[model samples]
Structure formats: structure tokens, C-alpha cells
Target: MKLLTLRLTQNMHARSSLLALALCVGATSGEGALGIFEDHADIGATRRAGSAEYHAATQAYTVSGGGENMWFTNDAFHFVWKRVSGDVTLAADISFPTAGGNAHRKACLLIRQSLEPESAYADAVVHGDGLTSLQYRETRNARTYEIQSGVSGPKRLRIEKRGKYVSMSIAAEGEPLH
Candidate 1:
């Protein structure tokens, strides 16, 4: 599908609280009211609102939102998600319409425990610069941690949730997800 994704880690100082520029995300999904999703909304209190649009003809979703960052105690990004249980998997072919935003900007396939900003969660993410990683928060209000991947600039990213552990697969440009 010729997509792009991102990931990042390491506790560095956060950027200034600037206005969130919309992140252009194009993804392939199923047909439903909002594609294969139950609903989409901002995960936490964000400076600006986020939106999600499903294109049936293209089977692509354009999701836009902003957040201070997708780490630490709270998050503020738009999420288009469905409720799933008992060993689940989520994947996406992602790309940004524009290039060269924040090096830390990301598009990810996430599994979160709740809608709350402090909910425990895990995400297989790709960053603007093509850094990919598996990031997680073990408990609500806990610090976020990351495990960097050997691969980068992946065109496809997938997350599989087993009983208690989460794993991921990544595909570079022109390669299949493995």
C-alpha cells in the first residue's frame, strides 16, 4: 500500500506546547459507519480537536490530531479504534500527506486499556524519520518505556496481543510484513 510509520523513546525534554498541527494519516480499513472502528476521538485533553474520515471507495481513513507527545503519563492524540478482547491484532499501512514535521511525530497501531489519558497501553509505532519501536506503559499513570527495533522506515506495522505480552512485525519499503 506504500505507507509510512514511526516510533521513538528516551526521556528527553518535551517540545514547547505549540498548537498541534494536524497529522495526515491515510490507512486501509474495512467498511462500516467509521470503517472497522467503533469510534474515534482525542485520547486526552488536547489543545486542538482531532478528526477521522473514512473513505469507502479508497478504503482509507484520514485521521488528524495532535498531542504534546505520545509518551509519559498523559497523551493527546486522535485515536480511531475498535474494542477487542482475547488475543487481538491490529495493523496499518500508514503515510503522512506532508513530510518533515517533528522528528518525534508518529503513526501507530495501538492497544490501550481505556479511553482515559493515563490508561495502560502499548503501541507499535513509526516516526516521521522512520524510527520504529514498541512502546508501552505497564500501568495507568506509569512512565512510558520503549524498545527500539532493528528496522526503520517501515511501510507496514502490525501489533499482536497475546495473553499478556504484545509483539510486532514491520515491513520496510517494498518488503512484506514479517
Candidate 2:
């Protein structure tokens, strides 16, 4: 005799948010796959909903969401992540689908401590207007701070973590990480 079986595994938070997401955006499991990350969107203090889709042919990910800002003590934005320890590097080529959106709307390569709204984190982000910066919050619920970069409208952004230090680099498409 032969038998077939199915297995399901999910974190409690992720399962709960997935349910809320279905009701809020009618999103499906396939629609939220962002290439490397199985989970998309962090349920936080946000007034809007977000979604992400991955295109295997082009090896690209598209994420869209609305948030007042990624500043202050808390944030509200779509995040796709995989937990990692020790040193790591994250880089991505990001662009907006339309020219019209909040000037502050941003795409980022982020490393966070937790899914909490005010988790200690750092990221290299590209804003709608081409502004690039390294933003971080050292402690939970603490004020966020930024170190603005000279590069503007970079087609690629990278953030690397080594020990307690984090560095950022940006470049135009086809250019080396600077």
C-alpha cells in the first residue's frame, strides 16, 4: 500500500497576519513570494496594507506599501527577511513603478532585530526622489537617526554588517558598489 501526506508549518505570528492580510488585501500565498524570502510584509503599526511579488524570469522582486514614514520610534512598511546571525551583506536594485508616490516612499535592504514596530535595525534605503541614506535605530522605541549619503537616485544599494559596525554603499546601475 502507498500513502500520500501533506505537511504544513507556520509561525503563529505569520499565520495570524496571513489571515488578516487575506481579509485586508485578498492576498494569496503565491502573490507574496519575494524570491529569497518566504514571508513578506511585517504586521506592524501601519494604516495601509502592503504586498510583494517575485518574478523568477528576471530574478526581481516588486514590493508596494504605504506608510506615513519609516522614521520616529516605529515604522510601517513591507519587509521581506530571513533571520541570520553574525556578519552579513544585503544589496538590491530598487525602483518605483510610477513616478508619482510619496517623495519619502522608500525601498530598502534592511537588517532588523525583531518584528516589533520599533525594533533595533539598520538599512540602506533609496527614496522616491533618489535620496539614499543609512537609517538606524539603536534601541527599541528609540528615535531613529540617519546618515545621508551623497549619492542620489542610485540604482543599487548595499548594507553590510560586521560586528557592531554597519556600512552602506551605493552606485548607479552597471557601476561598482561605492
Q: What is the C-alpha lDDT of each candidate?
A: 0.67, 0.61
lDDT value, candidate 1, whole model: 0.67
Report the C-alpha lDDT of model 2 over 5-95, residue by residue, as the tens digit: 1011112222111101110111223323444555766547555565666676665665555544668898766566665677776666656
Query: What is the Cα-based TM-score of model 1?
Result: 0.81
What's the alpha carbon RMSD for model 2? 11.3
Q: What's the alpha carbon RMSD for model 1?
A: 6.3
Q: What lDDT does model 2 reach? A: 0.61
Q: Residue by residue across 1-178, what tens digits does model 1's lDDT show?
A: 3332321221123331111112122343544777667788777776666667766666567766655667888877777777767777665666756666667767788888888989888888877787889889999999999999988777777787788988888886666788
Q: In model 2, which regions exceed 4 Å deviation?
A: 1-33
**RMSD vs true structure, all candidates:** 6.3, 11.3
Tally clashes: model 2.
1
lDDT of 2 at 100: 45
- Which residue pairs show collisions in model 2? 130-153
